[model samples]
Target: MRIGVIGGGAIGLLLASLLKQTGYSPVLYVRTEAQKNEINEKGILYLPGEITSYVYAEHIKDLSQMDIYFICVKQHDICSVNSRLSGLSGTVIYLQNGMGHVDMLHNMTEEQTIVLGTCEHGAKKRDQRTVIHTGKGKINLALYNGNAALLTRYKEVLNDKRFPVEQVADWGIMLIDKLMINIVINPITALFQVKNGELLTNTHLHKLAKVVCSEACAVLEVNEQQQWKRITYIIEQTKENDSSMKEDIALGRQSEVEGILGYVLKKTSHQSSVIHFLYLSIKALEEKRG
Candidate 1:
């Protein structure tokens, strides 16, 4: 099946590589002509051993030909291309960190199918043409509001043991579950400039992670103690990996703090000083970096 992957960031490249490795010719939708030319020429390198796989990269001008489109851009960055994707046919799978993009799905044409999912896989962009698979995790997806046939079609194209795909009934809970992980790890790691595991090692940062997670749990109406265990579990699993927000800070790019924390803060009935502080700090970092 022909597929389209939007965003040239780590996850996009990883998805493109996985699909290419599985014998599907997936087109990568990138922002620049240079990226397009580079992927077309040298191909995307999936690293551990720097193995290269070729996939076509196309400009976003035409998404009509794709049978399915995977929106892999950051939650905040999705807006830049939102209008372009509005009328496009086929199933649109959105892979984003927090709940911020949920409202956008409401704006989709009735014909446009929405599949919401989160990537558990950890990937880092080593360079313009290379992405390293830091952690292997399955994808959990559910239909927001669409025909079941579309979900089945995407599952057929993407499901595999290496990159297994599972269907969940409630997309809201699935995303919030991911948000729990992101709200804890992303800001703490980004603020302290550490890897995912370091949070567990440092007592101060570890406490901070708990504070944020606790506040988020209260706001999201999730069990605090239970979600804390899940957060710790994630830290154990991805200890060596870098949080996406940390990478974004290092790269001098805007983060999804707004989507991750901003969204949660809005849901909160009470004030969380620590979460608010972290949120403002990340926004300051984003502005300063810019």
Candidate 2:
């Protein structure tokens, strides 16, 4: 199967490398000239573990020829890049950070086949061509537009390779669960300028994470209309690693606090004033840092 990977950052490049490693020859399509030069010049170096070796890709080409496309750009760029990628017939995988990216991409694709993919396969770029796998969380997949054939093909690859894949019927819950994790873990870590684990050392940080998670859980319980989410479990998952947002802030990169905390605060009508406070505080923190 021909897979197309968009964005050459950690997530996109990692997924593309995994697919290619497991007998699926995939083409990687990146946006920037710098990224293109990096991928072409050095190729992708994926290290799943300390002992794992690097894998180079052969089908590096344009975006249209892909049978499955992985969209892994930052949240703000989702709409613009997806708009440019309007005419693809393949299933698109959203592997970026933050929540609401699928909705933005949905607006661009018009009910097009999309994959709501999640991975805690923690990756950080060692260099432009190399990425280091920091943690091992299973990859989850959900079908949005309802293509059974595409879903089957997706599961087949993931399952055969022993990659964790779940075809969630109601991905909004998954989105909420992820949002809960991102909301708490991301901001506190960013605000404190600490690793994900460092938040635990501060009693107030732990309380703050709980507060953010609680707010997110409340919003999810009402808005997405689901209860299967594990809010506490989500918060605890990234207690050790540095959150993507925290890392972004430390590196002077923009974050998705707007998409994660701001979305729930603005879109969902919650009566709790504490939720509003938490949301606003996080928003201000991100802006000040940005």
Candidate 3:
């Protein structure tokens, strides 16, 4: 299968590398000509093991003519590539962080298969051609709309020992679970500039995280206890890693706060004080940093 991975960020690089390792010559579509040239020349440098996988690289405009595509861009950038994606006839799996991009998928043609994916692995882009894999986690996939058989087939084809893939029955549930984790971890860690582990280690932060978790569960109408358990388990699993929002704040880049907490705010009938506070805090930090 000819796989195309859009966006040459951390997740993009990691997915391209995994595809190469899984015996498929995947095309990695990057944002710039310079990055494409660099990656084509030096290949993707995967860290921890220092493995290099030489995959094909092309410009994002040339994203058509692939059997499958993994859209690894952020929520804010989804609109920029939606037009290009609409032209393709293959399966397009979106691996964005939050639920903001879900509405856009409704525009896809019935001929094309759309899949929603949530990545649990912790990855950091060191440079144009290098990515550091901080933690290993499964790629949870749920069929948003389209062929269920194709989804199941790719679930097996993409599942490797190093990079596992699991299919969920409900796309909404899968995304909500990930959103809850981001709601508690992303904002708090960015606010305090702490790692994932600190949310549990720091008693004060832990308390704040619990309160935020409760608010999120209330807004989403999910079981707070179950969500809290899942959140803490992920925190422990990726403890050494920095949340993506924190990285964005530190680098003066825009975070996915709107897709995350902002989405929660839109869903609630009444105002959630804690969620509102975090939402404003993240936006304030973005303005100050940007």
Cα lDDT of model 2 by residue, 153-253, tens digit: 77766664434566666767667667766776777777777877665667887777666666666766653223224444544565566778877777767
Clashes of each: 0, 4, 0
| Every model's TM-score | 0.96, 0.84, 0.97
lDDT of 3 by residue, 1-290 (tens): 88899999999999999889878899999999999999999999999898999998999988768888899999999988888876679899999987999977777898788999999888999999999998888899999888999999999988989779999999999999999999999999998999999999999999999999998898899999999999999998888899999999999999999899889888986674888998899899999987
Query: After superposing candidate 2, which stretches have Cα over 4 Å from the reference?
Result: 48-62, 106-111, 222-237, 269-290
Backbone clash pairs for candidate 1 read: none
Best by lDDT: 3
With candidate 1 superimposed using the best TM-score fit, by how many Å does residue 28's alpha carbon deviate from the native?
A: 0.2
Candidate 1 residue 155 C-alpha distance from true site, Å:
1.3
TM-score of 2: 0.84
Give per-residue lDDT, candidate 3, residue 202: 97
Write candidate 1's Cα lDDT for 145-262 as tens digits: 7798879767866788766898888998899889999999999899889999988999988888888887888778899988899989999999998899998998898899988988
Best model per TM-score: 3
| Winner of 1 and 2 under lDDT | 1
- The candidate, 1 or 2, that scores higher on TM-score is 1
Alpha-carbon lDDT, every model: 0.87, 0.66, 0.91
